[model samples]
Structure formats: structure tokens, C-alpha cells
Target chain A: MERELKLMKGNEAIAEAAIRAGADSYFGYPITPQSEIMEYLMAQKPHERTGMVVLQAESETASINMVYGAAACGKKSMTSSSSPGVSLMQEGLSYIAGAELPCLVVNVQRGGPGLGTIQPSQADYFQTVKGGGHGDYKLITLAPSSVQEMADFVKIAFDLAFKYRNPAMILSDGAIGQMMEKVYLDPQVPRMKEEELPSWGTQGKKKGQDHKIITSLELESEKQEKVNLRIQAKYRQLEEEEVRFEAISCDDAEYIFVAYGTSARICQKAVDMARERGYKVGLFRPITLYPYPFKQLNKLADQVKGMLSVEMSAGQMVEDVRLAVNGKVKVEHFGRLGGIIHSPDEVFNALLNKIIGG
Target chain B: MDIKDIIKEENLVYKRTNVLTENIMHYCPGCGHGTVHRIIAEVIEEMGIQEETIGVAPVGCAVLAYNYFNVDMQQAAHGRAPAVATGIKRVFPEKFVFSYQGDGDLAAIGTAETIHACNRGENITMIFINNGIYGMTGGQMAPTTLEGMKSSTSPYGRDVEMMGYPLKMTELIANLPGTYYVTRQSVHTPGNVRKTKKAIRMAFENQKLKKGVSFVEVVSNCNSGWKMNPVQANKWMVDNMFPFYPLGDIKVPQDK
Candidate 1:
């Protein structure tokens, strides 16, 4: 039997999980809500002797590049920031993706567009999933709703990044980042064996084998197209194999709630409130935003009369919901932005007005 | 035998012993990159750090420096070699790491990365090649181009009315408290090449001591860009570029 763990905030859990997952380096600049991550790692990193480097960069740009460099050396590395900082990391992120280097980036998203407030918001949904940077690449995006998941997902993110040889992102909002809950730290997972990884990593050139070069540049059009095709195939595999979600009370309900990250938490509260008032409503939470759990949403669409997509952004994920529903059920969107998180009551009322009656 | 034959025979001996070759550089006949590469390779060999050293090559001419150096190397995206070097050094603090960057790749496009890397006191070495023009891109004006120097982009001789003055990166980086050693040297003459080797060795030594960021700006010639022969290009760099960007050690940490 597993023992119950002590309460911890999601941000603290992520920091702890990264260490437990065998991250060798962390580079980040201070940003609201997520600063605790850098703080926690900085305090603990100096004690470890098996080569752990923690650095506070001059800016988000520098932080991401530091991660880029460390990752190139075949070290497990990470960084964390809120929306504005993630925006600054876009250039480096593109390079990381292009170079096909493995690293984890955590976005404890705040409201945005500019220097948005330091409050919790999921306005970065489109940016996170739809390739925010100037390229045709996708980052493996994970959405964790609970503190336990926050701790668990760091390891998962690292695993996926290494598996795919690409960047992985944990898209949580300020609320999830700051919220406190019980978390049990698992025994540290062992890193993948050298043979299991692509032999191209900078572990040093082998004695007889020729020096391996890891580069994204393909000067020939045919070669570039082949790489693109490979990337697309991997993305298709992720969509088929990695889609994850949670569904609640959908068997007898005619209306459903679709949300992710912090919005899902609020939607859960709304579902509970609606059930209390004798309104049969259900909730569907997508845990993987990129390889979205569209199959689950489509199955729910057959029983529900309509689906309400609530987010902190202005209906970014709603497009996905509509595509999943594909006219089988009525789909509508509600959102708030610039650091404004929607209240449970607001979502509950909106569901009632739009799906239940009005 | 002619000088070429002697150099070739010496190169063959070098290949058997020194791990670097005297192969004619792929750079234009008079480009300064070859000189810079020779000095760097000499310094690394002299320091006996070939096995322990890692180099980062940028997106410009030196992007292929990895092909020449016998030690391990990693290539970075345009203007990002310094950041990559920072990462490598931070994780493997015991390893000797350096970045060889060019005018367009470092001073212009990668200015933010270079400045912040220096300012953050990352324990790494940076060899900045300031040729006053983007040689790899066919004679474009670079951030270090003198105000009156003409290039493909600034065909009007870089008018002060429009284009800005040449940036003195060493002088600028010297002001940052995080930097432990900052120097501007040249590679136009045999004496200057020796001076440059000393500067590079000093920077590498600083990293060995974990003293923090060490920067060396090599005032170099781009004969192809300037449309001058090798000797004239060196002369032009001395007569025109040197007065504006004088060479010396701007800062060396007292602690070191």
C-alpha cells in the first residue's frame, strides 16, 4: 500500500520532480508564479555532485539558449516561465525543435498579449499546441490539472522528449502552478541506457566509429522533405498512441464541459455545482493538448446535446472541439484573457444559459 | 623546393603528429579566418587541451571549423554559439569550452546572446572575429564595419548619416562586471598572430581557473570583402580599422 504524501504546491512539485527525474541542468529567468521553480532548484542544485548546474539567466532568451546548449551535450535540461517569458523563448524553442534536441520547457502560463498580469490564465493554448514560433514544427505538449499530475508529468515530459528527440512542454497556468495539494515523490527513475538512445548524442566520438554529426540542416530539397515526412509520421504516431483525457458523468447527461489545464479544474467545480442543482452535466478534460483526446470527445458527442468549451483564452481549443464534434453536437466557447481566470460560477451559469435552457 | 611544397610537407608531418592539417583553407585567398584558425589550433595544441576541449562553431564561415579542429565540436544555430557554449560549460564545468564566431554571426545577429552570455559570467571562452564585413555572405556590411567602409549592402561607403559606426565589442564587454578578462587583439601579422595566441591561451587559462567569462576580439581582415589583396587588406586594417578599434587588454581580473 502506498502512503499518503505531504501537501505541496504544483510549482514545488514540478521542481522536485525534475530533480527526481535526473535533470542535470536548469536555466531560467525569474517570472511570476513559476519563479518558485528556479528558486527551489537553485537552493537544492548546489548540493548534488553528479553534475547539476542551475543558472539564473539575464533574460528568457538566454535561459532557453542555455538549455539549448546543455541539451546539445546530451544532458537532460529544463526551464520554466510564465507567458511573457515563454514568448521570449520562442526563437530558441524553434531552434531546439529544428535541431531535434531533447529538453523540457514548462510554461506556467499567465494572461498575455503584452506584459499581462501575473495571474493564472490558459490563454496560451493555441500558442503552445499550434507551434507558436516561426516554423512548421510541433512541441509535445502535456496539460496537467492536479498537483500529483504536476509531479508525475515532469518525468513523463522528459521521457517523451528523449523518446521523440524533440522539445516537450508542460502547459499549466498560474493557478495550477501555485495551487497546493498532496504529492508523493516516486523513487527516482533511472535514465535510459546509452544503447537505447540515438548514438548521435555528444557522449564523445567512439574509437572506430566515425564522428556523428547532429544537425537539422538539409541543403538538398529531397533530404529536407524526407526529414519533414519523418517528423509528420512521428506526430501521427503521437496522435494515435498518446492521446489522454478524463471523462466524468457522461452516460446519462445531455450536456458536457470540455476544458484543459486550470480551466478543467474550474469546469469540474461547475460540473459538481450543476449536478447539485439536478442538472445532468458531464466534464471532459484533455490531458494531452497536442495529441488531443478527440476520440473521447467524439464518443461523448453521441450522448450529449451540446458541448461547452471553456478556457482562459478566447476560444483557441474550441476549434479542436468543433473538429472533434464535427457537427454531431452543438459546440460553443467561453473564455477570459489577460490574467483573468474564469470563476466556477461563471462557467456553471454559462452552461446553464447556453446548453441547459437559453 | 618552393614555399608551397615545404608547407605541404610540413602539413603532412603535422597530420601525423599535430592532429591539424596545413590544407589550404576553403576561405578566400586572403581571408583572415585561416589565420585565426591557425592561431587557435596552435594555442589549443600548446595548452595540451585537445582531448578535453569542446568547440562551438557558428553559422558563418567558421561553421565548418568543426571539420578542421581535431577536438570535439558542436554546431549552433545562427548567432547562438555562445549560448550553446555556455550550456556545455555549465554542465561540464571541468571541460574546456570555447566559441569561434564571425562578424555577422556574433557582432550583428547574435549581439544579444553574446552580451548576455558575457554579462552572466558564464565560465567560457569566446573568440570574436571582427572582419568589419560579412565575408561569407559576399561583402555585406557588418556591425563592426567602419562608418565609411563600403560593402555590398552599404554600397555608398557606410555613410555616417545612415549606417552607424563600427561597434567596439571588447570595450563594451569589458564594462560588464561579470567578465573576468576582455582583450582586443589582431591576426594581420606574424607578431599579431603570436599576440593572439597568447590572448586565447589567457582566456582558456581563465576558464581553467573558473575565473568567469573571458573574451578576445580579433581585429581581422576580409580581403575578399574589401576587394583588396592580402597585403593591402592587412595594411588597410592597420591604417583604417586599428585607430578606431585599438588592441589591448581592457580588463583582467585582479583575483586571477
Candidate 2:
């Protein structure tokens, strides 16, 4: 089917794409930057047309639990919030992962340690990728830099979520969430209609069908350990098969800049600037932040002289870069904190000064 | 009667409802959870809504309630059952949705969820168990703990000036316009068991009519948590717990 290309804000694109991807329910609270998601859905009235359910929950805590309830029934459900709201959802997120439910969570991150600025920042890099919630689990995290990806990755995130029976997050930031760009949205795909609901879902199984129990509590330490080990194994598989990244000008580049999301976009501009200025600083951006692309980063580390991590936050993802590079090459970080996004010139200058002789 | 005669199929006077699982109860010998579970299971059997019922279990002693309910079940994080149940009921309005919660999970940690869910008039059932103390967490002070109640957290006896009076959550929710039927019942006696079962049945029945939230609170006993024998716990409950957390209907729909 032919798709229509529409100019959409990243937050708006997320709502539209979720509906097009056949999400059965969306429970969200009003939050800065990403509030447009629920606002868009409400105005569009997808519930009347596509039979989707859009509800403004009392809080981020309620929103995530609502998603948990519906997702436990094997439905494609989602919730979106900004950084502060995301913190409130950690408890439910932990349970959702523990119960092995499939759902989509979009975190349009703003600057934060407490109640920080309502501007774009990749400050939650460690929080989202390292499982901000309690316990040993991993969320399949995708960082979207463009409004197009903000739209496109909704379906992809839900797909990966259901495929692996794990929660998937689109780790976007306020800049991309509020920015407008051309995006092609596929036609409305009906919600997943499995011939038979997954055996794990709470769909009220009939007589003789094994009663489905969705829970994260295991009293027996031995049993809990087995479950933890099983989740760990799945994560290992994700590292091997789901590690995603984009390498720009890395084939014969001496300097490599590592970043993601909005910062990655800035690094792209820095790459162009470096090339124009007769230098060879390439950009390596990890699309999936959780899997981290360690193998790819290490291989590139063996070739490049050094790596400089450019981000909006105070050097969160840079730690991952160091771990991946493992001192194979000198790695440095430059960041504009408290929601101050660095300009292309600033990032280029940092690359020139930190990695190359200024 | 001879052994052969007594063993005849027709001679069977009672059998367990298929709605309950084979898992032996993890509850202490005198806990009210087991009886309440039986009553709910029996009601489901009589009502024939087992296949359409989805239960949200709480994070207290009955956290493993999912294992016992034969219907599809989801375990909610502490105090979020109402919100979770609201989600299920919203998505599948035709299905029977209910949340099983304890006093600590409901009145204390999850007060906001409980109020909001009811205020929205969600067509679901809420089963609240008030045992006065947190059983699974080892006799911690619950919101429903009386002013002079003694628990692990309130060892010096709850002082009204410091710890506050017991929270009457059932009476409070009765004021919410979203609630169709609100009642507080008990399961310590055979007569009370019958009444509580009736209350549970009505809660489930109202969901079929899409009649807003039906709230049922059961004042239960936790002998082990109370540090008393089963018989003494029952006596203690009737003497100390009754006046504070009285049983009977708090708010019933006019027509009903």
C-alpha cells in the first residue's frame, strides 16, 4: 500500500505511528515535549475510527501500570512521557519486564537529576539502557534522531517488543520530540490478532486450558535465579543479533565521534564540518543503546586514533564508549548539560580540540 | 454405611469448585485468605463467569493469588491493582475485571489509584481485604490499624497523636459517585461467609450490567500476624477489630 508523507513533529509522529501500528491502547499523562503525543491522539480520535483506546491517566505511575495490564493480555499497548515522568514509571517498568510482558514506552528525555529543564537532553542514556527499574533486566532501547525515525520506530519497537516478549523503549529527546520533519506513515495496521493469544496472556483461558498467571514474584531463590538466568541469556542473544549502529566515514577515518539521538545528529554535522576543514573525524552512532554495539565500537577503536563522545547530558553514554573501547584508544567526552544542546560548531571544535591538535 | 456404599459417585455431598487450583494454600492455618479465596471460587462456579473473569492480584500476602485463581490473572505492583484492573476493563468492557488487594496496598500506598478508578466509574469489581496489619511483611502497621493497635511498626501501640486513627477506606469510597455497591463484610463465621460470598457475587454480577465499580471490603483475621492462636484471634477480632472496622453494607444502590 502507498504511504502518505506528512510533515510531523516527532512527538506527533509517535502517536500517529502507534495508531497506524495497531496499538490497542495508549495510557499517558501530560508532560512537556511529549505531551503532544496524547494531545495528537485525542484530537485525531483514533478510538472512534481505529477503535484504539487513548486515556489520560492520573499520573505516569498509573499510565505504565495501565500499559502493563493491557500488555499482559497480549495487546499492543504503549505509554509516552518525559524524563521526570519516566522516573515515576520505574516501578511498573520493572514489573513489566519481570512479568515478561510486551509493551512500548517512549521517553522523550529532558535535562534531569531532579526536576530539571524541559529541554532536549540525552541525560537518561544510562537510566534507560541500564534498566532504571530494580532488578536484572534489559529493555530493547532504540534511539531516534529524526522525526522520521520517531514515526518509523514505533512499529519497529512494538515488533521487537512482542517478538522478544520484552518492553522496548524509543529513547528520544525533547529536541527530536518537538521538531518537525517529513515522515511517511504506513496505513493503519490492525492490532495484533493472534489466532490464539499467547499462552502467557491474561485472556481468560477456557476450560482445560492452563490458567495464565502473570507475575514477577518468585519466593524460591532457586526458581528466581533460573528466571534471571533466562533473561540474561535473552540479553546475550540481543547483543549478538540486535546490536544496531550507523558508521559514517569510518572506512578510512582516523578520528571517530560516538553519540546517539539528537547528539548523533549534531555529530553528523560535526563530521561534515571536519571533512570540509580537511580533517577526517567520522561519526559512529548507536541506534540501539542497550545492545551498545560494543563489538563494532571495539573494531573501530582498533583502527581510529581516538574517540570523542558528544552528548547533551553530562557524559552518561561516554562511559559506555570507554567500556567498549577498553582503553584501546584514548576516549574523551564533551557535553552541554542542563538541556543546553551543543551547536555543530561547538561539537566540531570539541572534536578538533579533544581528539585532534587544536 | 459400608465403604463401598459411601464410595458411590451419587453419595458425594461436596466437591471442590474447578475454579480453584490444586496448589495447597500458603496461608497460615487460621488466615481468612483461604476462606475468602474459597468463597470467591465458589461464587465464580455458581455464576459461571470463570471463563470471562480476569483478576488483578496485589503484592501482599495473597501475591500468589494468581496461582490459585483458575481464571486469567495479572499480578500488579503494590497498590496498583485498581489502575491495572481499570486498564483491563477499559480494553475489554464485556469481560469481568476485578482487583484483589489488601489494606496496606489499598488504603495506604494506593489511595490515589483507588479513588481515581472509582471516580472514573470503571465497570469492575474491587475486593479489599482489611486485616489491620500487614501479614506478608510481618505485622507492619497498616493504614487500617487502630489507634491502639500493636504491630511490628507500631510496637508501642499506635498513638492517635503520632500514628493517626485507623483509616475507614470502605466508608470513604462509599461517597464516590462511581461506586454502584459498596459493602464491608466478614468471613470469620459461617453466616458471615455466606454474606461475604453474596457480596462477592454481587460485585461480579454488576460488571455484566456495566454498572460502575462495585466495591467489597472484607475485615479479615491474620492469626499468625496477630501472634495469637486461631481461636484466640477470632475472639480478639470480634472484641477489638469489630467496633473499629464494622461489618455490613456501607453503600448499596437504591434499586438493589
Candidate 3:
């Protein structure tokens, strides 16, 4: 099959890539910046083309539970929402994580502590990386900065999710979700056959097999503790092997900028502006936020004078950057809150004032 | 004849369904959940769909129902069993899927899930156990608790002015075009038990026919929650509960 290249919005790319990735079902509710994902799926009629199922649920709570149901059957299920809607899904996500079911969730983030603005923001960094709901669990978080990555990470997130038997999230923002760019969508991968499904799935019992019971409940405290230990071990493994980041011109840099998703894009341009002004500056964009590239940042901390954590929030990801650097060198945070997108020049000025001047 | 001879295969009048596991139920003594679970197991065995049936257990007293039902099961979050069942059935339409929930789960916190799932006409069966109180949470007020019904949350005989009226979820859902069959039954008596079993069998059959939602609400007695003994609870259910949640089919398929 030929690789199909087309100009598409990031949301449309997510929808198209999901169908081509052979997803079995998508359950979601309409939310700004991410509503186009379901819209594209419904308009494409993937049910006729690839036998995929698309449903618009009544609310985010319902959407995530539906994903939980389909995922329990060992199907490739997914859901997408913006900030407030994603908050509504935390309980279901916790249940899915506790049950050790594999699925994909995308959050095209908007600003919020409440019904915040529909515009782009990276305020959900703490919510996504740390345990958002009750209990100790981490989503295999992937941050996509461009529309192409928006299409590409859908397949990648699903693969990582199934490989680890854990939920994976594409932590994008409204900018990437709504922006348009050229993307080469992958060829169709066939959906998994019934025989190919994992043995743990609760898709009814095969002859001579014990009943497959998918649940997160363990009344015994000892058993629950063991479950928690096993999950922690998996997280350790992810941190050791799955930390992904991109470094641009950090080989001989005096200052460094750490960011993710939309912030990373802005910092890239800021890095260019600083280099033009004869200051050695580099941008470190983390792709996997949960298995954060802390070790890599620590190595850079030895070489750079200081680091600035840039994001569209009131300094959330900066805490992780500071932890990674661990006082080896100065680390500061620069952000624009409540749906404000900081320009490249503004980032350069912050880099000079917060990191260099300080 | 000796007892062994009386227990011979040919002389056997009743036996437990193989679809039910040998595991002991965790339900309280005289609780109706066990009987309802048995009827469902029997229906699965009779239909011979045990291999293709999936059950969703809710987060109430019957939360551990997965342990007793000898089939594939998924335990859902509080009040989200219907949404979960929708996911399973949509992905595997040929399989029979059902969600078992309680009064607090279905009629209160999960009302949106229940209403939306039924409204979408997902091809699934919903088994609702309405015992009028939150039995697992220590007999708190439930949306199905009768008027002036005293509960832990409603300490003063359920002041109607403050507590409001009990919900009739079965009749309410029956009005939706998505539901193909709706019925309210009880298991306080042997005859009623048989009728309830028949209703469950019909609900499963409706799933096979791909006829939208088939809702079976069992108005049962919760002796532990009601602060009454098993016998008194049954008598009280007959004298008080039936008048509010009368038994019988609320909807059925019309002959083509």
C-alpha cells in the first residue's frame, strides 16, 4: 500500500491514524479542540471501511467506562477529551489502570482549575504524570509537538500500552490539536484476530479454560499491596528503558530550555533566537513525560550554566525539571497562564532573565 | 429406600446449575442477590450461551458477583456498569452481555449512565436489584427507598419534604423507545422466584434477538438494611413495597 500524504489538522490526523492503526472502537464525548477527532471518525464511516466502531457518549465519565469495557475484551479501544472532560474520566482511568487493562487516551488540553478556557494550555502536566485519580498508577505519557506526531503517536501509544499492559496517553494541547500540517498516514494494520487476543481478556471463556474475570478489586490488603508493588516495578522498568527526549544543539551549550508538547515548539524557536544572539542555548523536548528523561537532564545540568522550564501553566513541569537537575545548577520556570501562548521572543527574554541573569 | 437411593440421578427433582461456580457466595443470609444470581446462571446454562456470555458486576453488595458466576465477567465502577456493558456489546455484538446493579447504583449515581445506555439502545440486558437501601454502605437512603421509609441517612422516617419521592427507573426506562422489554418482579416467594427466572430468560432471549435493552428490575427484601428478620422482611415487602413498585411487565414486544 502507498503511503498517503495529506494536509490535515492534528485532530483529523489522530482520527485517520486510529482507523489505519486498526483500532476496534472509539468512545468519546464532544469537547473543544478535540471534538474534531470524533467528528472525523463519524464522518469517515470507518465502520463500513475498516469495521471500526465509533460512538459519541453522553459524558466523559461514560466515555472512559466504555473504553474500559472494550479494553477488557482485549480490543484496541480509545477516547479523547479536553481538560475538564478529561478530569471527569479520572475515576474510570484509575479503574482501568488498576485492572491492568491496555488502552489509549488523548487529552488535547485546555486551561483550567475549573471550566477554564478552551484555548491551548499545558496545565495538565502534573495531572497526567502524577497519579490523577485515587491510587498509585502512571499513564505511559507521550507528548506530541506537531501535527505529524499527532498522527504518529496514536499507533505508538497503542503499541506501548499493549506491550506494558498499561494505559498510554498522548498529552497534547489545543494548539497541536487544532493546527494543520502535512502528515503521511500509515498503511492499514489489520485488527487483532480473536485467537491473537491476550489470554487475560474477558471476552467470554474458551472451552476448558477458567473463567476470565477482569477486576481491580482485592479485598485482602496483602494481595492489594502486592498488586501495587508489581505496578511500581513496571514503572521502574519504564523509567529505565522508555525515557525519550530530543536534544537540539546541547553539545556545547551554556544554557538549556526544558519543555514538552506546545511549549517545546515555542522553545525550539527561542533556542534559535538565543543562538543568533551569541548565547549557547539548546532545547530539550521530552516525548515521554511519565518515564521522564531525568538522567539525560542531569547530564546536561553538569555542562549548562542553568535551565528554564517553559510551559503554558503556572509552573507545573518546572518542579520535575528542578528535581531532575537537583541543585547541580540553577533551574527556573517561565510560563503564561490561563490559555496565553508565550511567543518565541518572550521565551528568549525569560531565558535571559530567569536563568542567565539569576 | 435409603437416603442414597432417594438421591439417585433418576429421582433427583432439582440440582444447581453448572454455570454457577462451587465458590461460596458472600451475600448475607436471606439476601435476594444469591437467588437472582442462581436464576441468571440457570438461564445461561439452559440457553447454552455460557461460552458466549459476558457479565458486568456493579459496585454494590453484588460487587463480588463475578466470583459466583462461572463465566467471563468484568467488574465495573460504581454506577457505570451500563456504560461498560455498552462497550462490550458494541465490540462483540454476537455475544450476550448483561450488567447487574442495585438501587443506589442504578437509580442514583449511575442514573445518567443507565438512561444514556438504554437511550442508545445497546443490545444488552440490565438486571437491577432494587432493595430500597444501600445495603453494602450500611443501609443508607437510596433513590428507590419508599416514601417515609426510615434509613440511616433518612433517620426520621424519610421526611418526604426533604427526601423527595422514590424513583421508578424500570417504568421510566420502559418509556424510552430503546428498551424492547421491561419488567419488575420479586423473589420473596417460590412462585415469584419462578416468575423472576422466566423474566430473566426472556431478557436473555431478547438480547439474542438484538432487540435493544431488556431491563429486569427485581424489587427484593433487604433484611439487614431494613432492620427486620427474613420472614418479617418478606411480609413487609408484600404489604408495603408491592404497592409502590408493583410486579409485572411494563413493556413487551408487539407481534409483527
Candidate 4:
């Protein structure tokens, strides 16, 4: 049986969940709103043994490279930081993704553009789901709305990273990362065994066999194009197989509230208040940002009159909503930036202006 | 047959015909790389580690060292061999891991990785070749080039007043407490070659024993970059570069 927990911050949940999930290495430089992760790992990691290698790198560059090194060896590894530090890690992230190495990176996002503030923000929506670094690539981005979801997503991120042989990012904001809540320490479900992992891991080549090679470089244009095509095909398979989301009372509703991560939490409050006020409103939250649940959105578009995209960025995810709606519903955007989080009242007012007042 | 007789038979066959016999070496004739490769091959043969060893070739001239070395090798991005080797070694710690890097690759762009790896005392062997100039990139001045040494980048010679003096990586890394063994050797002549082979063997043994961070810096000559015949470049390295970067073991823990 499962029990309802009290409350825990998102950052603490990520660190604890990573520990429970058998991460062997945690290499990161501290950044605001996410320092708790490093602190938690430093305090609790040594006791676990489990070959945990926790190092405070001289810089984010060093930290990510260290993670790259550890991850290449098939060790479960992770790192956490805020927006600025995550920006610094983009190059290494790209390399990890290109090399098809499994690792987890948590972004407890604060405001951005350059040391923007330590407040909560969803301004990295585009950067996280789309490619943050150069070249054509995508990260498996998990957007969590609660501390429970944060804990649950940690395991999911690790599983998906190995499933796809790529990096998985937990995109949270300062409000979720810093908020205090209770969480379960142990996962109720079973974890995978080491032998279950892909045989490509460099644990030592088979006896009387050639050594395995792990590299990202393919000098020939045709060979690189083939690799890109294979990656795209895998993404397409994910779109078909792994898209997940939650729909809250969208049947016969006039207006739909679409949000994710912290914005989804605010939209939930707005939906509840709007329902109390006799407005026909509902909410749709995307759990996975890359393999976006567009089919569900497309189905909702046929019924709803308008969809409001509530984000903390100016209008990043609104583009995807527009594509999913496909001219069936009017798509509108409401957002705040530079670490300012929107309240339920703000989103409700935007809904009123777009749907009721119209 | 006895083991010695079997070894002699194999050596005789290898002398007559080997897989590496036909590959046109891009390295200049008499370049130290050829000798270095021969020594590395001999070491692998002696230690019986060729099948188990994984070598990382750096982005400079030895970037193509993979072509000649009959072991499984990976080519790293410019100056990223330490980082790559760190990955390979951490994953397969039992494998005999080593990185072949040049002065430009190790001391210039990859300085941070090399220093931190040594400081962290990673159990790996690093064969650092300090040729005093960037040979693969057309005679560019390297971080280990002697003061007042002219190259493509240092048109008026590397002035101490302008560009800083060449770096002595062995002395610098020796100061790190994590370094277990740090030696500076040369591969210029027969005597030095024997010393270099001994140093290489010691480094491999250190890794085998799980002693941390064995570093061997080979002060070599880039004859093409120096615009000298191979013999002249060897003499120049002995005359000018050795005094600045002395050859000897800078640090070795007494316990080891």
C-alpha cells in the first residue's frame, strides 16, 4: 500500500531520489536554489558506499566533464544546477547526447539571460525541450509539478536515459526546488539490475574480443547523416510510445488551460478557483516535453473554444500548442519572466479576458 | 617448444612481415614518433597487454597513432585525451589505460584536466611527449617551446618579454601531492631511449599496482618544425631544451 506524504522541496527530492536510484557519482558546482542537492549528496552520499564518487568540481565545466567521464564508464551519474550553470553545461550536454551516454542532469531553473535572479522561472522551456546546445539533438525533459512528481521523475529520468542512451533533464524552477514538503525515501517499485543494462557499457570487453569504442565523431557526411536519421527515428518511436500527460476535466469545457512544470501547479489552482466561480475551465499538463502529448491536445482542440498557454517564459511552448491545435482552437499565451512566477489570479484573469469577456 | 623458442619464432616472423609494415607513416622520416611507436609496441608485447590495453591518441601528431598501434585506440578531441581516458579508465578500471599526448595537447588546452587528474590521483599512466613546437599544425609555437624559439606563430622568436617562457609540465605536476611518480626523460639517443623505455615500463607497473597518477614526460624533437635534419634537431634539443626542462624523476613516493 502507498501512503500520502506531507511535503518536500523539489531539489531535495531529486537528490534523495538519485541516491535511492543507485547513482554512483554526483559531480557538480553549486548554484543558487540548487545548492541543497550538492549539500544533501555530500552529507548522505559517503555513508552509502556503493562506490559513490561525489566531487565538487572547480567549475561547472569541470563538473560536467567529470560526469561525462564517469558516465562513459557506465556508472550512474548526475549533476544539478540553476539556469546559469545549466547554460555553462550545454556544451558537455551536447557531447553526452551525441555519444549516446546515459546520465541525468537536473535544472532547478532560476531567471536567466545572465545571472537574472534566483527567483522561480520557466524561461528555459524552449531551451530544455528544444536543443540547448548546437547541432540537431533533443533531451528527454521531465517537467514535475510537485515534490512527489519530482521524486518520481528522478527514477523516470534515469530509466529513460538508459532506454534512449541519452541524457535526461529534470526541468524545475526555484519555487518547486526550494519549497518544503515531505516525501517517501524509498521507491515502491523494483529497480533494474546491472546485468539488465545495455551490453555496450565499457565494463571490460569480452574475453578474446576487440575492445569497444565509444565516440561521437563521424567525419564522413553520409555517415553522420545516417546517424542523425537513426536518432530521428528513435525520437519518432518515442513520440509514438512514450508521450505522457494529465487531463483535468476537459470534456465539454469551453476554455482549456495548458501548462507544465511550475506553471501547471499555478494553473491547477486557477482551474479550481475558476470551477468554483462557475466558469467552464479545465487543465492539461504535459509530463514529457520532448515526446509531447500532441495527440491528446489535438483531441481537446476539437472540443475547446480557446487554449491558454500559461508559462513563465514570454511565449516558448505556445508555439507547440499552436501546432497541436492546428487552427481548431484559438491559442493564447500568458507568462512572466526573469524569475517572477504567476499567481492563480493572474492566469484566471487572462482566461477571463480571452474566453469569458470575449 | 619452450616459451623462449616460441617468442623467437614469433619475433622472426614479425621482423619479416607485420600488419604495420605497409602503412605509409605520415610522420617525417626519423621522427621520434616512429621510435616511440616501436618502443610502445615492444612494451605491449613484453607485458602481454596489447589485447587488454586501451590507448587514447591525442589531437596532435599522434592523433593517428591509432593507425600504427595494433591495439584498440580512440582519438580524442584536441587536448581532450585526459578527459576521454578518464572516462575509459573509470568504466574499465581493470584495463591497462594510457594516454599519448603532445605538449600542445597536454599543457595548452588540456592543462586543467591534466592537473586535476594528477591532483585527484587517478590510477592511470600518461605518456606526455614535449616536442617544444606544434608539429601537426605547421610548426606553431607550443606551450613547451623554449624561450626565443621561433616558429610560425612566434615569427620574431618567442620573446620572454612578450610571450612567456616554455612550461615545464613535469616540474609543475610534481608539486601536486597526488602525483605518485613524475619523471622527465628524453628519447634523443640510444642511452636516453633505454631510459625512456625503463620509465615507460615503470609507469605501466605503477598502474598495475594501482598506485595513483604515474606521469612520464618525454622531451622529444620536432625535426620538421625546427627545420633541422633529425640529427640536428636531436642535438638542438639536447643543447637548448634540456637545461630548461631537466631530465630526472621529480617525485616518487618512498612507499612505492
TM-scores, one per candidate: 0.91, 0.98, 0.99, 0.88
Which one wins on TM-score? 3
Q: Where does candidate 3 clash, by residue pair?
A: none
Best by lDDT: 3
Give one digit per residue, the lDDT tens place, for model 2 in A298-328.
9999899999999898888999999999999
Worst 10 residues of 1 chain B by lDDT: B14-23
TM-score of chain A of each: 0.95, 0.98, 0.99, 0.94
Worst 10 residues of 2 chain B by lDDT: B86-95
Candidate 2's C-alpha runs over 4 A off are A194-196, B1-7
Calculate the i-RMS of every candidate, to one decimal place.
2.2, 0.8, 0.5, 3.1
Error of 2 at B41 (Å): 0.8
DockQ, cand. 4: 0.36
Task: List, in order, the clash count of every candidate structure.
Answer: 1, 0, 0, 5
Worst 10 residues of 4 chain B by lDDT: B13-22
TM-score values for chain B across all models: 0.91, 0.97, 0.97, 0.91
Tell me the lDDT of model 3 at A235: 90
Instruction: Let me know the TM-score candidate 2 reaches against the reference structure.
Output: 0.98
**lDDT (10s digit) by residue, model 3, range A129-149:** 998989999999999999999
lDDT of 4 by residue, A1-358 (tens): 5543646677878877787777777888889989989897788764344546677765676677667766766777788898999997887788787777888999998887898999988888788888988788889888888888888888899888888888999998899899887776664333334565466654444556555555566668999999888878878887898888998877758898999988998999999999999988999999988888889999999888899999998989999999999989789999988888899999999999976675
Each candidate: what lDDT? 0.84, 0.91, 0.94, 0.81
DockQ-based ranking: 3, 2, 1, 4
